[model samples]
Target: MSTYKKYFAAMALIWAGCAVVIILAYLLLFAPQSRRRLQTENQLKETKRAYRAGLKAGQKDAQDLAREQIQQMQHGLANFVTDAESSANLIFDLSQIANARQLDSFTIKAKDDREKSEMSDYKNIGENHIDVSFTGDFNQFATFLNAMERHQPVIFVDQFKITRPKRQGTANNVNMSLAVFVRKNNES
Candidate 1:
């Protein structure tokens, strides 16, 4: 009821109104701006992720490339394959080695008659698999494998298992799994 108290109450009410107006202004203006900033940040993050993924997909890994080069160098001929026909001679060469060793039951079969699948990591390098089975004495089989390893471009013998058949006296059944890596480009 006193004039001073009335004046003080009016001041407090005005200050409170000003505070409410400021809060409303922030809610109307800064709030949307903050939301837009957050959206932009999220978009930027997504773009960066996509760009990183593209970079990863575009370039080959150095260590992996080095390992491939080393393998090719060891093969003695980097221009080992250009296409399916280029690698077809592997089967024939293996046949020759078997014939030279006089390996009986010498049978070679391609895992897939078609060309190398897209599973290969390198666009220019190709990989092929074959299952070679033969019957011969241990010595003959060893000689055959050495000859294959010594073949000009080098053939990788993944594995070989020898089992003696009951009927064959001293002959051993040799089952071999081979992995051949050849370059699709003659560039070596």
Candidate 2:
């Protein structure tokens, strides 16, 4: 071969080898790094999407809970009364209940103003306090208490005392302090 042709052939071979080395370096080093960067970006996008979905679900859950609580409060408000006349009517209902149970004697008295003041701190809420005394057999007393519990106005028994006369064949006496809750108009 001619020397000029040989030199040209050697130069072409060297150029081809450099090209292969560059391609291999790119595949081995730069390609993997670019793949990793693409994967990291995809993961970040997925994380952001999941975070947004979770936030929306949490907001919906909180709204549902708030709605449920508001409904309960509305129901409670419906059952509450606001006036003295209604309180007296509830007491009259109690007397009728005692009559139905055939209690020997039933009496009720209102509590003092000092006692009512302590419970009036809650907004638009008031409590009616009464001392009740009755005389009846055990079965009749149980029926009377159950009737009171089932009555329209809610009654709470605060304290109770029962006594049996020393003499046989006498009815037992019961004394109880009761509190009934009522809702009042917001006065200021």
Candidate 3:
């Protein structure tokens, strides 16, 4: 080979080796760094998003929540009642729920006034527990309990119990106590 041709061949071989080294360097180093940087960016974004959501939740958790609850309590307290007519009407309402649920042998009776006179703390909120017993399927009983919980007078379940059915395909016997917290109205 001529000297000039050998020189050209050597230069071409050096260029090819440099290109291989550059490719190896990129595969070994730069690509991994880019992947790590992308991962770090995603993590940073997620952390910032969580921080912003926490800030929004923190704003909601302020004293305004307490004030809102107090307002609700005041609104509920406005419906306090303690008269024979009110008690009778409330009983009728409960019987209506039992009837709607198709419960058998439903019975409800309000506890006497001695339980009411004891009052509940400084709020004067007293709970009058009513004895209730009925025979029904589980579905009907569940719906009855749901209706009682969402009743307009704010009824709460106190004592709840259930007995197994005496025979297969028979209704279960259930006995429950419900409570109503009410302040005495001036008219009473």
Tell me, by TM-score, which candidate is best: 2
Clashes of each: 0, 0, 0
Off by over 4 Å in 2: 1-72, 80-83, 114-118
| Best candidate (score: lDDT) | 2
> What local distance difference test score does each model get?
0.81, 0.82, 0.81
Over 4 Å off in model 1, which ranges? Answer: 1-83, 113-119, 185-188
Q: Can you tell me which runs of candidate 3 are displaced by over 4 Å? A: 1-73, 79-85, 113-123, 185-188
* Deviation from truth (RMSD, Å), model 1: 9.8
How high a TM-score does candidate 3 get?
0.53
Better of 1 and 2 by TM-score: 2
lDDT of 1 at 68: 88
lDDT of 3 by residue, 14-92 (tens): 9999999999999999999999999999999999999987776578575577679988987766555344336567788
TM accuracy, model 2: 0.59
